[model samples]
Target: MSPGDEHDSFGGVGGSGQTRTRLPEGNSGDVYGGARRPVRSSRSLLAVVGVVVLLVAAIAFANRGGGDPADAAGTSPRKGAPAGDPTAATGVRPVKAKTGTIPTGYAHDEQGAQSAASNYAVALGSDGMFTAGPREDIVRATHDPAVADDLVKRLDASYSADFLTSIGLDENGTAPSGLTFVSRTVPVGAKVLDYTETSATVEVWCTGLLGLAGAGSTKPVTSAWFTLTEKLTWTGGDWRITSSSQTEGPTPVNGDNRASMADEIAAAVEGYGGFTYAR
Candidate 1:
């Protein structure tokens, strides 16, 4: 109900089951018989609130079993690679440059794999991918060239106008005027489960923010926990992502914090930029 009280809605992308039918472009009154409808009664409002709380709890519980998926038995590659001692000279700095503001130059060894996985998570969760130019840079920097090419086409198709409108954002992922949309990935920890000279796999556990800030907003910024599993390979002397996947969180309960106003929330996002998370 308030700005900072977004703990319940922050990470959710859609209402459980709400649909809206469109009216013809210039059809005044055709949409709803040109009549205003009565607001929900107090009892109905109470029931809705109760159901929302229950749904949030259910979602939190459901996201806990986050290891590998059921179908990953044979399809997923084997976990962590055989132990091989790696020293700093070559392995330590495979990918360590800035492709602009974004991190690039991922190594082609174990450490490289870990760095690639973590940074890739950041790129995947970023606001940049909502727009065209930065989105392409992200894909090219994080993924293998071949994969990047294919993904760019698919990503362009995926972030279409309809998709943007459905999620309360414009085609570029910007919220409406006076609104601030938030999306980011913060890496909490990472581990290299398996690795070889040319390819490696790493898992990163991350927390993220996904929501919109604005007055009278029904959706507020929320938190989510998701693990990113990345399959990477050595190419052009650095680790490049070949593929990756994400599953919902091992999410925790919300802390008791007073909610802020929508304007305040939007201002905070505008004033603060994200960090290059580590460890």
Candidate 2:
């Protein structure tokens, strides 16, 4: 693993000429494009922020938020596990930055927290998010090294051997011949909940695609919704993930467009690779 375990693998904002949301129309929702899903409500949006703040507070409360003296003295939590790689600021940058419209490297406050949460969502939903190599890089980049292994292990299991094969890949995460895997999160908007110098919580509501696109492919692109609750800690002068979780929808309706041919879809997936999203 790059720096963490597989379990941690489980892990966006935007605006444009087009918009997407999770709420229904009668419910006064918003709509995001590409996938053509329903939008999130203002109250739901607030929930996103609330969830993030509570995450930090809960974790901080659990760890006593680390004494200022210990952190200030640079003797806080030890960076790694006894049997695993020592958790230290790797001093490496995240693989890439982006989530629909939100920028990476957000300001180190509530906004930054939201940015981290949003981008973390993208990282979680990204195609690379499923593979072990990129997955570990993202975990280490986004999280406190102390928790990286736990998260990685959890992710590894989440994407088990059977799961990968079912999704058209071998044990190594490679998609079957002629198939292009598509799992990406596009952010709609973001909000901040709470933040401190070393810790922050943020929520990112996102629309994602999870499936394979290819000729003769049975699994076509599909949409999903879930809020990513990310707990972030500052490391090496940048925000990284400490811990995170995912839950089901807030999903929206499917679009009216006729499904494209599997070959066309596959070609698109292969020809147009994903972006390293930036605000």
Candidate 3:
């Protein structure tokens, strides 16, 4: 790092999924990893990449439907009072099937919109977004027929060779031989930001895990929170993402526990299947 270059740390702390990077002062090097130099000027890189978490991409499931789970219309609360079920599962699976790990098909109603947004948040923030093959498929699944091609091209450019290297990944976005590249999003909750018969805007609050996990890995796996806003439309018998964006925070203070060793963290991530998340 040069003396004149400014060091600004960009991070997100939400309900569970994102990455936060800190660039220390005093002749310290890049924020991404060890001695590898940044591929572009720090400011331009940050502005262009939006720190991956905010990388302007959308994720969607394949279209498949059998029995759609529509939200049963119910009376609203008397004026001035608010009403909602922020966290609860219907004991019903929202989608009939999945494409790879991505779920497919959703009802054309408010509940389904919330479910789609929450699940897509997970896929968009997943490790798959870093690699080429899966990235293309993910965008395809984003399923906005009008924009899929453009999105694929834009995403390819975003996760470029230099960007991958800065984060200690290879051309294929694979972590160094022994390290496990981890990126997963856990949606804390979802809200119907806006709704219409054929379209809806939903916000998914997430706490995500990201980075390389293994001994001697500079980018040790870390977790943070952020919210993803997805605009979706009911198309081809399912809900598809039309567009999306992200923002940091509603963050909480750090906990007292010390940071875990790289190996320990990796083990926990592997051994634990994870907690059940409700709609």
TM-score of each: 0.65, 0.60, 0.70
In model 3, where do residues sit more than 4 Å from their true spots? 1-84, 89-92, 274-278
**Ten residues in sequence with the least summed lDDT for candidate 3:** 1-10
Q: List the residue pairs that clash in candidate 3.
A: 13-225, 14-225, 14-226, 16-206, 16-207, 16-208, 17-206, 17-207, 17-208, 18-208
- List residue ranges in candidate 2 displaced over 4 A: 1-106, 273-279
Which tens-of-lDDT digit does each residue in 1-279 have in candidate 1?
Answer: 101110111121111121211111111111111121211111211112111111122223222233323222222323664442332233243445766555667555566577667666766666666677877787687677756666676666655676566556777767788777776666656778778898787877666655567896645554445566677878887777776645444443333355566677677667655554322
Better of 2 and 3 by TM-score: 3
- Candidate 3 TM-score versus the reference: 0.70
Q: Write the per-residue lDDT of candidate 2 for residues 1-279, one digit (tens) a residue.
A: 122211111111111222212211111122222332222211221122111111221111112211222111112223551221222222333223433332345555554465466656655555564577766666555566676776667566555576466556778878787777666566554444557788776655555555566767665554445555566777766677765555434444444455566677556555543333222
Q: Per lDDT, what order, best first?
A: 3, 1, 2
Cα lDDT of candidate 3 equals 0.54
Model 2, C-alpha of 166: deviation from truth (Å):
2.1
Query: Could you give the C-alpha RMSD of every candidate to the true structure, in order shown?
Result: 16.9, 15.8, 14.3
lDDT accuracy of residue 103 in candidate 1: 62
Q: Write down the lDDT of every candidate, Cα atoms only.
A: 0.51, 0.46, 0.54
